[model samples]
Target: MNTRILKSCLLGAMLVLGGCASGLTGETYSRDEARAPQTVRMGTVESVRLVQIEGTKTNIGTGAGAVVGGVAGSSIGGGRGSIITGVLGAVAGGMAGAAAEEGITRNQGIEITVREDGGQTRAYVQEVDPNMSFAPGERVRVLTVNGTSRVSK
Candidate 1:
């Protein structure tokens, strides 16, 4: 009974955390970006560097962790001891959960520096796409929509 509830809560938390992540690849676009016009510029890749994209920090992760921790901790003891352990568990769980959520959603990205045809140089960072690779001297397209830009072959 208690185990079932715990499992359900954990599953729910996982689902919520998973739903929070969205695609950050060059080929991915948000719903609002669909049917929108983008400005395109031709550029030559000046450099490419690997980077890490940070994950989100949200109350959902912390709250869910706290709940799970509290439940698990409260089950450990009785009376006041249970309450104390529950509180401590909630605190520890919250921190662990937040970190877990962030780590799970973090992405590998690339910082692509490009020299535009207009003689302007800029760097754009996007989640690394397994299907596309960029080299320093390769020609690419810089597409900008609503001030957000991505580099693609």
Candidate 2:
């Protein structure tokens, strides 16, 4: 492959991998969640802790990376040597791509420990929303739908 074509392929793969990330913030909802009924409970935040939200794992990232790597590696030598390097590149690229996808999509989150009005204590974890901030003793609402829960002011 030409150098220009190789660069373009790599760039396209990166874009595809980046686009696979989805929002996990309290204010963000999946299409299935829209207009759905949710159980709402009133609570007071007892504590707030910072946390890390792991990224998604999908075949798209690994496959894209492998293709890019295989092409790059195949360009390294002639004939049989190219084949060997291509295979090795695909394996290494797959692993690297998975890690890159995770790192790229990883998010900062919060663990909110709340005391419900009904006297039940629970903790909710969600990706941090830039527009929202939680502090100890703040009033909050715990909303749950289809067993997924979120905390909001």
Every model's TM-score = 0.97, 0.94
Which runs in model 1 stand beyond 4 Å of their true positions?
A: none
Residues 70-91, candidate 1: write the lDDT tens digits: 8888888899999999899899
Worst 10 residues of 1 by lDDT: 1-10
Off by over 4 Å in 2: none
Question: How high is the lDDT of residue 145 in model 1?
Answer: 89
lDDT of 2 by residue, 1-153 (tens): 457766987898889977887888888889899899999999999999999998878887788778778777788888899999989988888777778778888899999999999999999899999899999999999999888999988
Residue 90 Cα positional deviation in candidate 2, in Å, after optimal superposition = 1.2
lDDT value, residue 84 of candidate 2: 95
Best by TM-score: 1
Clashes in model 2: which pairs? none
